[model samples]
Target: MPAEPLATVVGLLRDKFDLALPETSTELWHGHPVWLDDDLPVAGFKAYPTFVTVLFWRGQAITDHSGKLNASGSAEMSEYKLKSVDDFDSDLFDVWLQQVRELEAA
Candidate 1:
């Protein structure tokens, strides 16, 4: 069953990032919800029996973003599981989103 928060978050993504979301069902990579972009892997979200995980692609692209991610509450999170909706931080996520946009443009 899809959680309300998941749909809400997906909406948040489409509204904010304009990422033409991949046809994501329950999938995993690095052991988490694999939200794909353009048939290639981009971002991911993990859904435990109880919660959802949000994983960002281009992690290497943000090598210097640890402080921002941590301060904003997106730090050192499970590279495998997300247990709360709060785990999805749009602020830090927006940066990765921008990277995706730039990559698409280029």
Candidate 2:
């Protein structure tokens, strides 16, 4: 982990982090990188054999679902994933940021 694992994940989250509050931070949760706001996690990430897990918290908060949040490939996570760097889409990242905002607000 030349850069930290969370750092790597946050680098990915960087695509969606701006819209959320500054209180949001990253940590290791069950050996995964997790993002938190006011102590409540907004998202988490993990890299498996063939994919990655991008777990969005406040998962219970999203009421009006629109936009893209994918959990494809073999990460097998219950939340969304981007699997590869090529999958990082700004529009979808914006959606994830929106979810982060909603979570922080709660």
Candidate 3:
């Protein structure tokens, strides 16, 4: 993938995450930016060759009526893949973030 598009998507995601997850700590874990709630992985994003994947650690437990999140990895993990900026949905993302926070707290 080209750097420009990737950068734009990453910038948007980072800014949104920063604003929505103010109470969480963000760090580069395994070379990917991840938000942690007291050392527990809450959410994160990883850039792949064809797309960017936004992940919720306990997403399987989240109530996503939109059906955008796809089960990923093990445990309760889920992911939404974006091929470009156009694929990003702010409203859905916001809702997911809120659910992720609540799940983390629980």
Cα misplacement distance, residue 46 of candidate 3 (Å): 0.6
TM-score-better candidate, 1 vs 3 = 3
lDDT of 3 by residue, 1-106 (tens): 3376877898999999999899999999889999999998899999987789998889898888999899998788999999989988889889988888777767
> Candidate 2 local accuracy as lDDT?
0.59
Better of 1 and 2 by lDDT: 2
What lDDT, from 0 to 1, does candidate 3 have? 0.88
- Global Cα RMSD, each model: 6.5, 5.4, 1.5
Backbone clash numbers for all candidates listed? 2, 2, 0
Best by lDDT: 3
Please provide, for model 1 over 30-105, each residue's C-alpha lDDT reduced to its tens digit, 9 standing for 90 to 100.
6645555555555555454665444455544444454432212354322323344565676656665666555544
**Ranked candidates, highest TM-score first:** 3, 2, 1
Please, what are the lDDT tens digits per residue for candidate 2 over residues 3-22? Answer: 34434554756545634545
Model 3 segments more than 4 A misplaced? none
